[model samples]
Target: MECCAFCPTESRELYKCPKCDRLYCSLKCYRNEKHWICSESFYKDQVKEHKPELMENEPQPEDSSSKNFNPEMFEDYMKTFKKDTRSEKEKNPQIRVRADEDILFDSDDEPDYVRVVAEKSLEEFEKIDMNDLDRKLTMAGLGGLTDNDEQLEYLYSQLNDEEKKMFNRLADNLQYDEMGLMNSVFGKNLPKKK
Candidate 1:
């Protein structure tokens, strides 16, 4: 069953608005609802006005070639182009209007689902102690010997299955390239070469 974009009601029958491409349950629901799709007649009239030449099958004058076109024809073309552009801008006024007043702000009454999910993910991420490894590495650095193999093993063990796979792939690529795995792991600045 398809749900109406505007309303909470769900229906098996989906009626798509020709103008805005929004779906509705019934004609009555659509008629009563305040949606951008309701302005279909206005758009239809615009379509009619913009393509005036398409509406009629008038034959071009044999004497009036493209090279010999009058200045009036050029003026008419420019006027038509300007009118069409203006009509398009008028149709989507919200997009063109820079003022905050002209913009249609979403109601704060409804909570955004995607935003809620993102916030939850961020909260979870914040709870994780990412600096724990760095602290451990810093303490280990106090010792003269920085055990790179042990550090790599520890880091690799801490990673999830997907992350471990990616790490392994990177290690494989580094091995195939005949460069120090340390250079690939810790970047060029590190003096360690293996």
Candidate 2:
């Protein structure tokens, strides 16, 4: 198990910092002196992501040429919108919210240890897999799907037996759900409406 980069606790459950990618065990450790810079930057990044318009200039209004508005056209638009929404909801009745899972790990459960290293060293690698490339990039260990496979394999390898069992169960559930969603969306083997 890898120890928390901030404090000396063996992190059973870990969260990777969005900005720095350093592993921290808890919120306290995440807000610590060493990790504070990254935490602050991560917060900023999140804000920017969620509210990108804050950085960009305000959008200009539509051209006055659209002043010739039609109420009949808007009524037709609303009818089509309602019809589509109702049909969509009826088509995907299997879509429902699932209960939230308790995946958070508490680092305070374990005894704290003094910080061992003053500064952490980064290991440099020659090859970096860029996951946004063309389909041919998959053969070179790149592309989104390839990256996801690699990540899942690495995380699965890090789990214990119990965790592995839970992970498999979750994966099975996800697979089932995915199949159901696909079948529903493509109107394959759907029950006839009475």
Candidate 3:
């Protein structure tokens, strides 16, 4: 383990802050340290020194440009902005609520019928079985398929005992036909088998 930069006496057991590269022993120490506090004179001085360009490039309000801006263009811009904001908020609903509060604080108070329906849907989703090919394709994502046989062999070798058994079963069922196996695993049509 690395030693803490601030306090050499302490072990670097905590994660280093990506922004400052400072090692903290714990979240409490990170928050309580004089360097961490926003009100600290040294902290303010460091921020100003390190990010002088940011202060210099602060956006100035459009003085006369806003007056001359077309109403139609402004409407269109507002529409686009609203749509993007709505989508973003939908994706992260917790942002609209207070960070300290729970979003599903009353989840326990939900109706028994609603709870049953939700549980049933979750159970159905969990029951879906994935074949070996399906598993590989899912893991591959947009990378499509591996071209290197050695990489594929290495990946196969890395599988645990149970996974190895599954792979062997899949290969046996596939009859060692690479093209057919690829197609079956990815649920795509195979090219003409040579």
Query: In candidate 2, what are the lDDT values of residues 1-194, reduced to their tens digit?
Result: 88998888895789888778889899999988676567666776877899987747533223435544332443643443324336433666565533553222354333331122212212222233344344557567554454668778876898999999887888776886776654565677765332
Q: What is residue 39's positional error in candidate 1, in angstroms?
A: 3.7
TM-score of 2: 0.26
Q: Which one is best on lDDT?
A: 1
Superposition TM-score, candidate 3 onto the true structure: 0.21
lDDT of each: 0.63, 0.62, 0.59
What is the TM-score of each predicted model, taking all chains together? 0.20, 0.26, 0.21
**lDDT of the structure predicted as candidate 2:** 0.62
lDDT of 3 at 96: 68
Clashing pairs in 3: none
Please provide, for model 1 over 62-107, each residue's C-alpha lDDT reduced to its tens digit, 9 standing for 90 to 100: 4454644433343553443323335435777656665544444455
Look at candidate 1 and give me any clashing residue pairs. none
Location of the lowest summed lDDT over 10 successive residues in candidate 3: 76-85
When sorted by lDDT, best at the front, the candidate numbers are 1, 2, 3
Task: List candidate 3 stretches off by more than 4 Å.
Answer: 5-108, 111-114, 140-194
Report the number of backbone clashes for model 3. 0
Ranking by TM-score: 2, 3, 1
Which model, 2 or 3, shows the larger lDDT? 2
What's the CA error at residue 41 for candidate 2, in Å?
Answer: 1.4
